[model samples]
Target: MRRHTDERAHVLVLHGGQQHSTEPTSWRQLSVLRSRLFAAAVARAGRQDRIGVSFLRYAQRGWNDGAPLRDATWALARVREEHPGIPVGLLGYSMGGRTALHLAGEVDALVTAAAWVEQADLPAVHPPTSGRALLLHGTEDQMTSPEGTLRAAERLREQGAEVDVRTDLADTHGMMRHRADWHRLAGAHLVQTLRTSTCDAGGRGAD
Candidate 1:
């Protein structure tokens, strides 16, 4: 993949499984939701024009099934290669959230919703204490229980990582689309998380 303009700090968005082919889709299935969330957060954080967002398309059969953790590392490596000095962040929803977790340490910060992290898939080495992570989930997420996020938070805390979690009070699965109210709440939370990390010694914004 070729590196694009370096005018803005980059965010690589990942989509959940909707097909099994290794081919690209005509339109990203989750672009709207991704853009809305990214836009809201960037605006709130006062970094609207300083940020760039792009999608990470991958091959998969279903949300839960994909190449093992080792294989998925290539994608993260590519992102790092594209922006050698720029800070990278990930915003993933649903199954895409799971992919973010596996690749968390590779980025400066991560914002995930309704994700699950299998122990075996975790990075061999945890991200340094400087790395930051945020997890959000719906209390009524029938597809992936709030427990999934809770469990991930627990593990991260145990490892002395900076991880924060927030759960929507009444939203169900696909909370990102439930209503404008949910979006507002989530958007605010995400903006704060990313903003806080931006000033950390290791959280330098892209140049």
Candidate 2:
């Protein structure tokens, strides 16, 4: 990871399930897409200098009976340790989106794409108290139910968190269609949310 000279909000991109592997690459193609989109969004907003991106590679790729949550937690801790006082965001896809939603309270902003939240025990999770969330789902997603994502979003909203749920009518679980729209919405949400947090913190900065 390249170290930045100045403090910047850090966004950690998490990938979905893959064939189990002991020697996985630190970053995957999906994660790369997410990171690039987020970076581009920030750049377009003229806030690229205030944000940094990273990836979390799992030791094994099956979601591991929720073990990925531990990995995600550790990654967030490391970000806090290395970039103390800066804001941090979590962006996950599919299984990774479930993990991001689970740990939403720990980060400054949360974004999930085609998240598998129905079976993730999301009803028991509390909404973030001081952060914003963006949940995206495909209406035609056969692998994961878009209804599940919408339900979760409603729950989060009822709990007093700022939540935005978007549905793509012409996409599937992979969200191959409307990829640009996903990136733009998510990236803009992250930047805007972090900016709000910064203002709330007296302009110190936010994740």
What tens digits encode model 1's per-residue C-alpha lDDT throughout 101-189? 76667776677776654555444325422456778787877777787777777766777887768785677666755546544544454
Per-prediction RMSD in angstroms? Answer: 4.9, 3.5
Model 2, range 1-207, lDDT digits (tens) per residue?
224567457778777774244445455456445444544554454255466677777776676568778998999899998888777777788878888888887778888888877644676655653646888998888877788788878878878887888985579876767877887887788777766665666554343
Candidate 1: where is the Cα deviation over 4 Å?
Answer: 1-8, 18-49, 63-65, 68-72, 118-129, 177-207
TM-scores, all candidates, are: 0.70, 0.83
The C-alpha lDDT values of all candidates are 0.58, 0.72
Provide the global lDDT of candidate 2 against the true structure: 0.72
> Alpha-carbon error at 80 in model 2, in Å?
0.2
